[model samples]
Target: MIKRLINLPEKSSFFLFGARQTGKSTLVRENLKNGWYVDLLHSEEYHLYLKAPEQFRRNSVYKIEKEGVTEIVIDEIQRVPALLNEIHSLIADYPGTRFIMTGSSARKLCRGGVNLLGGRAVERRLHPLTYLEQKENFNLETALRFGTLVGCAGKSEIETQETLAAYADTYLREEIQSEGIARNLAGFSRFLDIAAARNGEIVNQTGIGRECGLSCNSVKSYYSILEDTLIGIRIDPYIKSVGKRVSAHPKYYLFDTGIANALQKQLTAGLDPVRRGRLFEQFIVLETYRMISYRRSEAELFYWRTRSGSEVDLLIVKHGTIQAAIEIKSGTSVAQPDCRGLRDFGQNNPDVPLFLVGAIGQPFFLGNVQVLPWERYLENLEQWL
Candidate 1:
């Protein structure tokens, strides 16, 4: 098992949120195995708590007081949002009990609850395995093709592809249905395809709605559902004005490339150079996101695109200032012409460091911009920030 960077607090309660199959359960089981465990995903347990969350409190508090169990681990806590009320009370009643709750989605938990855990639990997020955790065993091709979902990692290429395929089929499709996020499963399924095709591009709700036969509002709601479920991210445009025209629309990216490919109904064998390059860009953008989240840095991730067509693939903003601008290229070698966007952005905001990531094996300097390989760039991402 890979070691996750999200460390559970020794004394305080915390929430571990992540997309399904990102190793939340595995991490909790491995690290908090000694705790009093509850699996909300189990049908029996889910109904038991849904019927009476107080039973959980009665049982767990009894065990904590009598059995000397100081830690309580609840998996899939979102399954019964009502339990959060009881949990909040328990935290107050039993100060010694360290409550660790894991949930794949926050939509339910965020609804109509005063003092969600009564300000007692700190919220922490988990993402697909970061390059630092996968380190020496990391495979760029596999990650780009199949993504970093821990369950699919280290499997045979065929098995990895199959696992991702099944994940899309069973988890994404059925889970959304079960969650009642979208009433029309068929329409949501179609929207999934359109959204996947538009991944890594600026969102156009009207355009997507037209394609999916959904209203603009419906498309917008669907996107919100994705965000709420932690299956995709919507990055707002960097809006500092920076003496240049910038686009206003936000860009969207699904959490995993393999799942995106599956939603698009495309096999890895069908990936052309253009498609592969786009996927590579998505992979790097996602890796950067995961790294930043794991580090818990005070930075916001955004993409810069101007009305005149100049673009910086990513901008890292810290303390209301753009600290770094990054451009991603799928090619192995970098040429001066390819550095046009970074150069232009640098000309305007020379204080911000510029980086160009490509498939090149070794690092080189292109004018004022630093050109580095994808792996090296991800490995040293924190330093750049």
Candidate 2:
């Protein structure tokens, strides 16, 4: 089993949220041993909880008092939000018990204004596998092509492609349609393709709405659905004025590259140099995002873009300070021109460390900006913060 980086609280209740197939269930099963498991995906358990949320409290109390159960895991807790009320009371009543709540979508819980245990539980997120977790088995090409989802690991090329396609469908059917997050499936599906195609580009809701035949408001709602369901993330443009006219729009990225390809209907196609470059940038951005999350750091990610088209791929920020300014390149070797954005960024924020990460085989430098292989940057990612 691959070891995930997320460490659950030893004795406190917490919510584990992640996109499907990211291995939340497996991680919980492996690390959280001897716990009372409740699978809400099971039809019977779902119906029982749906009919009588109070019964969950009664049963949990019995297990805690009679069967000496200290840990109770409720998988896919969003399926029955009512149970949260019961869990809330149980938590107050039994301080010794730990409730592990896992869910793939936070849309229902947040939108319904459901009881969130009154801040009784902390929140943790699980992301698609990172290169650090894969280690020796990590393949840059495969990750850029098939992504780092847990189910894609160790699978053949064809199997991985199939898994990604199915994953896309599963999100559409189970998460979007079933949850009623999108009232018009056809329009939302079109938006998804357009969104996937523009994965790392600055988001223009109006432009996307025109392309997908959706209203601008509808497009924004669709993006919100993706974020709430853990299907994608938005990296806002860095607002700090570094002597340039900064763009205000944010960029949206799917949780996994393979899923992005699948949504764009390019899963089986060969990745050309241009396509590979975009995916490579996406891969690096995602890796950095995942590492920051796993470390539970205060760092926030943003992209820097000027009106003249100069752009820095990522900026790591913490507590109103710029931690690192990163420029991603897909080429094997970096040239001075490739570090243009970093140089421009450094004109004002020279104190902030600058990095140019790409497919290079060795670490080198172009003046003050450090150029590193993607792997090396990820391995020592924590130091930058």
Candidate 3:
């Protein structure tokens, strides 16, 4: 197994939040081997707590304390948010005990007003596998086609596709329906497909709602559900300066490329050149974002676009300053023409570093712009940032 970069604080409680199948349980099990585990996903456990959350602690916490176990792990804590009150009490009663809560969804907790363990627990996220963690085993093509879900990464093509397909149809759809996040299940179902097709694109609530037969506000809420479940990421437009006419809308990218394709009902591995290129860009953008997040860097990612079509695919901002800009091209070769966007952005922000990441190219410099193959860029990402 690849070692994750997330380091839990030894003295404090924490929340490990991620989408389903990101290996939260596996990581907890591996790291906290002796911790007392209470999986709310089990029907009996969930019902038991739903009946009397206080009694759960009286029975389970007492046994754990008696056995001298100080670490308590509660998987899918959102299923029984009422238990948070008891957890908070336990923490106060037993000063040495630390609770680790794992959740796949935060909507219920936040909306239900559950105790977040304020100032007591740190929050961390577990994302899909990154190139850094996978090292030599990372395959760009495979990642674009099958995503980097650890459980599905090394499997056969058919198996991987089938798994992702099931994830989209069963897990994603059912979870939303069970959560009762949407008033109309059919409309939400249709919105899922439309949204997936438009993944990695600028948000257009009115247009999306028109296609999905939903209202604009409903479409916005649906997107919120995606964010709450950790299945989608929104990158706001970079408009810190008024020198350029920048678009105000934000771009949304599905958490995983494979899941995005699965939701669109596309199982074919190969695509036409233009379609393939877009997917490649999405794949790289997600990888870059994940790398920065997994390392807990002080970098914020954004996209820059103007009315006349000048665009930089990604802008890495650190400490409220534009540190670096990148343009993604899915071609094997890079020429001067492909550096137009980066060149335009660099005209105003001369001090910021610019790069062009292509399918395959040796690291080279074109004036102020640095060009590198996507693989080489990822390998030397630290230097770029």
Per lDDT, the best of the predicted structures is 2
152 Cα displacement, candidate 3 (Å): 0.9
The model with the greatest TM-score is: 2
Ranking by lDDT: 2, 1, 3
TM-score for model 3?
Answer: 0.95
Give, for candidate 2, the lowest lDDT window spanning 10 residues: 240-249
Write down the lDDT that model 3 would get: 0.84
Clashing pairs in 2: none
Q: Number of clashing residue pairs in every model?
A: 0, 0, 0
Candidate 1 residue spans exceeding 4 A from truth: 112-115, 241-247
- Colliding pairs, model 3: none
* Tens-digit lDDT track of model 2 for 109-160: 9899999999999999999999888898888888888888887878888899
Question: TM-score for all predictions?
Answer: 0.95, 0.96, 0.95
Span of 10 residues, lowest total lDDT, candidate 3: 241-250
Instruction: List, residue by residue over 109-150, the lDDT tens digit for candidate 1.
Output: 875353477678988888888778888897777777778888
lDDT of 3 by residue, 144-233 (tens): 877888669668988998899999998888777886666677888898999888888888899999998889989989988888989998
All candidates: CA RMSD (Å): 2.2, 2.1, 2.1
Candidate 3 regions exceeding 4 Å error are: 241-247, 383-385
